[model samples]
Target: MTRAAIVGIGQTEFSKASGRSELQLAAEAVLAALDDAGLTAADVDGLITFTLDGSDEVGVTRCLGIPDLKYTSRIPQGGAASVASIFHAMSAVMAGVCDVVVVWRAMNERSQFRFGQPIARGNIPAGGGSSFMEWCLPFGAQSPASWEALTAQAYMHRYGATNEDFGLVSVLLRKHAATNPQAWFYGKPITLEDHQASRWIVAPSLRLLDCCQESDGGVAVVIAREDRARDLKQTPVTIHGAVTTLPFNHEIISDYYHGHDLAQLPMAQRVAARLKDLTGMSPPDTQVAMIYDNFTPQILMQLEAYGYCGHGEAKDYIRDGNLELDGSSPLSPNGGHIGEGYIHGMNLITEGVRQARGTAANQVANVKTVFLASGVAGAIIGAG
Candidate 1:
């Protein structure tokens, strides 16, 4: 059997508005990763990306002038599919179906359209909206914040968590981002008081600061067999334990009612176990984490689900400065989606590679292993 590794990673500057097409953004990132890996389009034989990425494989292939493709695929389910794209590439390369697969995600989210605005209600069955979304749309639970707020409220109530607890996460991530030149919020760190004073987007709990930015940019990674990666331009970040798991009766973002527990993400917990089982490594072995912080509450929940802390203990763990660059867990030193640009969690994926490479702007100390999670899917990247 073959092993997979990420030999290259690249990104465009995170911005509110990128005055370019999605295809252009995708091509630029792809080319950057190829150059970083000391390879070219001719070395790529497969491609994988998010279903939401506006640029398709054919267009990106044409832009790169690639001769042919042996494999191409897309994964859906929003942010959850972020790491799943890497998982797809790993499987493809490991199984000998293809070699040198490029995984990418690019979007003109802000300049073209805003995700914060309410989605207009329509017939909506053009492979567009999920059937699960239709149930909550009529009740004004259309946007991600609104849908997630229900569960956030429940989590807060159960754990005695307040908005201040959530604010702590926002504050810490912004602090990390402040020094990262590529972060959109770079040089703009916030105080806890600032988080408290920020306006509410779906209130009683969720604040504007708690929500992630709608960024317009692109990120891409080059995955090659581990042996080939060892001979590349940079340290090979071996892909260990890439897994995606869903618990019984999983619904996309609207995981709040009936049988679904409102306080925890069961899928994430299962994924945590899967990672440990696959790699025989646990949270204590990791030097840094690049968890998806699409929303602040989810960040806390992920910490608990991934065994970094006990259930309902994440806020306290964070308050002790465990998430700081010098702290124990050292999460998302590149600012995460909250402070970094949100390209469907692709930035976090690249950050994991950066940590292992010792090239992160806000470097974690002696990082040999980096943990990454894209909602339900996750992977462990290690310097080998």
Candidate 2:
């Protein structure tokens, strides 16, 4: 099969308030990505983004003056759509449906809307076609933090993991972010003591520091056939594999009712298995792991699910310094969503591209392969 490669990446500054419309952010990111690829709006024939994005294809085309578009798509599952958007773009480019595909996500999540607020108090509707939310909203699991806290409690009980263990994850990522000039938390390193002192968002499991930032920004990447990408301005990062899996009984962030172990993330396991099957590589084979960190406990769950460690062993794995810059896994050297701004998970994908290109701010040495995962979806990108 033909392969696709990510040739360019761009993002607006991570901020609490972009002071712009989501459409403007999308246009700026897309144009920046195009410029990075040595292409223009005319070269873009395909577009992909999250279904939750406020900007539509028509708005983007109008703003950028894109003359013609051959393919356009939107992925669902909220932040899980980040890597899945690449999957769609890669499939399109490989199958000859389109070339020069652009995948982007833009949001005024902090200034215009807040994802951390309770659904009952926010603009998000109760049902919103989510049966899980319908069941969760009435019982006080009304926000993403609340929904995730339920699963975090079960995982902690099963593994004897405490809030301190999770706080370590936050500390490490913040350390990385402190040196990352583009990160929202740049120059703002925090200690485990600081993390512990932070107020609890969900008692006994999640702290205020454990949660990712509700950032306002946009991120975009340009993809093309591998052969064409080699001729672009930047090093081509080949998409070796991209996969998304939805196991039975799985809900979005509230994945507790799966009739299985709450300590394990079944969707992440499936995504990792599929990625391994497709790429002949597991988490250990990659140089950097850009696993999603919407919340700190999710990082531990994914660390295990992605084969970085045994089930219920992520706390030990992290304690052993495996996530350090020179350690075995070297997770999220770009600071991840916990310390970096979160454009959903799109920022993570861009960091993966940068790692593959050997240009990341906190670049992991000799990084040949970068692994990206967002719960149900994953992809492996390698330097080409």
Q: How much is 296 displaced in model 2, in angstroms?
A: 0.1
lDDT of 1 by residue, 239-287 (tens): 9879997666676677764375678888888888888999998755799
Top lDDT hit = 2
**Model 1 ranges with Cα > 4 A deviation:** 122-129
TM-score of 2: 0.97
Residue lDDT tens for model 2, 1-384: 779999889899989999999999999999999999998899899999887899999999999899999999988888999998989999999999988999999999999998788886333544322667767877888889998999999999999999999999999999999999999999999999999999989898999999999999999999999888888899899999998887887887878778999999888888888888998998789999998899999999999988899988999999999999999989898899988899989999999998888888998999989998899999999987
Give lDDT: candidate 2, residue 187: 98
For candidate 1, the 10 contiguous residues with the lowest summed lDDT are 122-131
Q: lDDT scores for all predictions?
A: 0.88, 0.91
Model 2 alpha-carbon miss at residue 306, Å: 0.8
